[model samples]
Target: MRIVGDGTRALNFFIDTLLVFLLAYAGFKTWNFYVMYWGYPAYNFGWFFFGILFVYYTFFELVFGRTPAKWFTYSKVVTAKGSRPALWQILVRSLVRLTIVDMFFIPFFGKPLHDKLSGTVLIEI
Candidate 1:
C-alpha cells in the first residue's frame, strides 16, 4: 500500500537527526555539562535518551500527532486505522521509537514503517 504521506521521509530523517542532535547539545549546554554527551551526563544515558524520547513522542504524538521535529517536517502521527491514537496506542508507538528497533534493521524502514507494523501512522499534514 503506497501510503500517500510525507514524500520526503528521507529528507525528514536527515533533518530530524541533525535537529535532535542540536537539541541534545543545547540541553547539555543548558545544564552546564560541557563534558556530557550533548546534555546526557549519566553513564546509561542511552536509557535516559530512550526514556525521554519515549515521553516526548508518546505525549505529543497522542495529543498533537506530531513532535516538534515532525511538525517541522509537515508530518503528524496517526493510528494505522487512520484515527487518533489512544494512550496505549501512543505508548506502543513510543516503545517502538525508543527501542530504535525499526531504525536498527536493514531495508532502513523508519518511523512510518515501524508505525505501520505497530498499527500506527505518520501522515503528511
Candidate 2:
C-alpha cells in the first residue's frame, strides 16, 4: 500500500472537520430549541463541539478503520505492518487529535502526532 501525501491528508481533514462541525451545530441547535421551549435561557455549547469531534473520529475510525473523508480520499488507516490497528491505537489516535499538535508536526515530521502515537498511518487503497 502506498502512503498518501499531504494533499490527500489535508482534504481528509477538511471534510472530516466539516462533518463534525455540522453534527455539533445540529445537536446544539436542537438543545437550544428545547431550552427556549421550556422558558430557559439559551447558553453557548461551544466547548461541547470538541467532545463531538472526538466521538466523530473515534466512532468512525473504530468501526471502519477510516472516516468518511478517508473513503472520499481513497485512503484508510493501518499499522506499520499494513494491518488494521488495535482498539487502543484507534482510541489514542482520536484522543490525540484533540490536542491539535498534529497540525504543526505533519509538515516537519512527515506524520501527525496521532499517527505517531497510535502506531497508524494512512495508506492509499
Candidate 3:
C-alpha cells in the first residue's frame, strides 16, 4: 500500500469496502450461508458490486472531487499535480480499482498506475 497516495490507501484499504462486504455477507447469512458454501457467490459478482461502488464514487468524486470517506479522512481525489479530476478520470480510477487492478493483484500494481493514468491522486487535504 506504499504507493503515491499510500496513506490514503492504507487508511481506506478495507474501510471503503466495509459496507459493501457487510451487506453482501449479511445477505449470504440470511440466505442460509448459501453463498459461502457456494464459494461466496457475491465474491464473483464483480460487475454488479463494483459497478455500484463505481457509480457511488464516480458521481460523488466528479461532483465533489472527493467522496465522503475521503473528505472525512482529510483527503481529496485530484490529479497528480493537484488539479481537480474530471468525471472520466474519476471513472477510470474507480474502474481500475473495481476490475483489473484490485481483483487480481491488490497492493500490487494498479493503484499507482491508476493515479498516473487517471491523472489522479487521493491527496491528504
Candidate 4:
C-alpha cells in the first residue's frame, strides 16, 4: 500500500463535494416544493446541506472506510499502522472534515489536517 498523492486526494475531495452538492440541491428543491404547496416560509438550505454532509461522510467512513470518490480513486482511509481505522477514529476523521482549514492544508502539505488529528491516512490500494 502507498499513501495517495496530493493530486489524487484533491480529486477525491472534489468528487465528494460535487456529490454532496447534488444531494443538497435535490433536498432543497424538494423542500421548496413542499413549502410552496403548504404556504410555509422557505427555509435556508445551508444548515440542511451541512447536516447532510456531516451524516454522509461520517456514516460512509465508519462503515466503508472510504467514500464513493475514494472507491473510484482506489484509495481508502487507514490507521497509521495501515490497518482499518476504528469507529471512533472514523468519526473523528469525518467530523474534522467540516473544518475548511483541514482541506486547505492538503494542497500545501500533501495530507489534510483531519488525517493527522484522527490518526488516519489515505492509502492507495
Candidate 5:
C-alpha cells in the first residue's frame, strides 16, 4: 500500500467539497421552495450545509472507507499499519476533519490532524 501524497489528498478534498456544494445547492432550492409555499421563515443555510458535509464524510467513510472523491482518486482510509481502520477510528477521523487546523495543516503536513490523532492514514490503492 502506497501512502497517498499531498497532491492526491488535496484533489480528493476538492472533489468532495464540490460534491457537497452540489448537494447543498439542491437542498437549498428545495428548502427555499418549502419556505416560499409554506410561509416558513428562512433557516440558516450555513448550518444545513455543514450538516450535509458532516454526514457525507462520516457516513461514507464509515461505510466504505472512502468518500466519492477518494473512490475516484483510488485512495482509501486505513490504519497506520495498512489495515482497514475500525469504526471508532473512522469516526474520530471524520470529526477531526471538521476542525480548522486539519484543513490548514493537511496540505503541508501530508497527513491531517485527523489521520494522526486517529492513527489512520490515507493510502493510494
Candidate 6:
C-alpha cells in the first residue's frame, strides 16, 4: 500500500468535516424535536457535536477500518506492520481528533498527532 500525501489527507479532512457537520445538524433537529415535545428547554449542541465527531471516526474506523471520507479517498488506516489497527488504536485516533488543532501538526511533524499516538497510518488502497 502507498502512503498518501497531504493533498489526499486534506481532501479526507474536508469531506469528513462536512459529513460531521451534516450529522450534527441532523442530530440537533431530532433532539430539538424531542425536547420540544417533552416541553424541555432548548440546549446547545456543542458538546453533542464533539461527541458525534468522536463517535463518527471511532465507529467507522473500528468497524470498517476506515471512515466514509477514507473510503472516498481510497485509503485505509493500518498499523506500522501494514495490518488493521487494534481497537485501542482506533479509539486513540478518534480521541486525538477532538483536539481541534491536531491537523496543524502535519506540516512540521509529518503525521498528525492522532496517527502518531494511535500508531496508525493512512495508506492508499
In candidate 4 the C-alpha lDDT for residue 35 amounts to 91
The 10-residue segment of model 3 with minimum total lDDT is: 1-10
lDDT of 4 by residue, 1-125 (tens): 69988789879989998999889889989889989898767879886677778888888888898999999999999899999899888878877877777777766656788888888889988
Q: What is the lDDT ranking, best to worst? A: 6, 2, 4, 5, 3, 1
Off-target runs (Cα >4 Å) in candidate 2 are 39-43
Each candidate structure's TM-score, on Cα atoms with residue i matched to residue i, is: 0.64, 0.91, 0.64, 0.89, 0.88, 0.93
Tens digit of lDDT per residue, candidate 3, span 9-122?
A: 756656667755655555445555665565554444444456567776777788988666676677777776678887688878877766554444435655555666677666
- TM-score comparison, 2 vs 6, better candidate: 6
Minimum summed lDDT over a 10-residue window in model 6 is located at 39-48
Clash counts for the predictions, in order: 1, 0, 0, 0, 0, 0
lDDT digits (tens) for residues 1-125 of candidate 6: 78999999999999998999999989888889989898767778886688899999999999999889999999999998999999999999999999978988887779999998888899999
Query: What residue runs in model 6 are displaced by over 4 Å at the alpha carbon?
Result: none
What are the per-residue Cα lDDT tens digits for candidate 2 across 76-119?
Answer: 99999999889999989988989956778887779999998888
Model 1, which residues run further than 4 Å from truth?
1-7, 22-42, 104-113
Model 3: residue 10 alpha-carbon error in angstroms: 2.1
Instruction: Write out the backbone clash pairs for model 1.
Output: 28-39
Candidate 3, residue 77: Cα displacement in angstroms equals 0.9
lDDT of 5: 0.85
Best by TM-score: 6
TM-score computed on alpha carbons, candidate 5:
0.88
Let me know the TM-score candidate 6 reaches against the reference structure: 0.93
* Comparison by TM-score, 4 against 6, better one: 6
Selected candidate, larger TM-score, 2 vs 4: 2
The positional error of residue 101 in candidate 6, measured at the CA in angstroms, is 2.1
Task: Report model 4's TM-score to 2 decimal places.
Answer: 0.89
lDDT of 3 at 68: 61
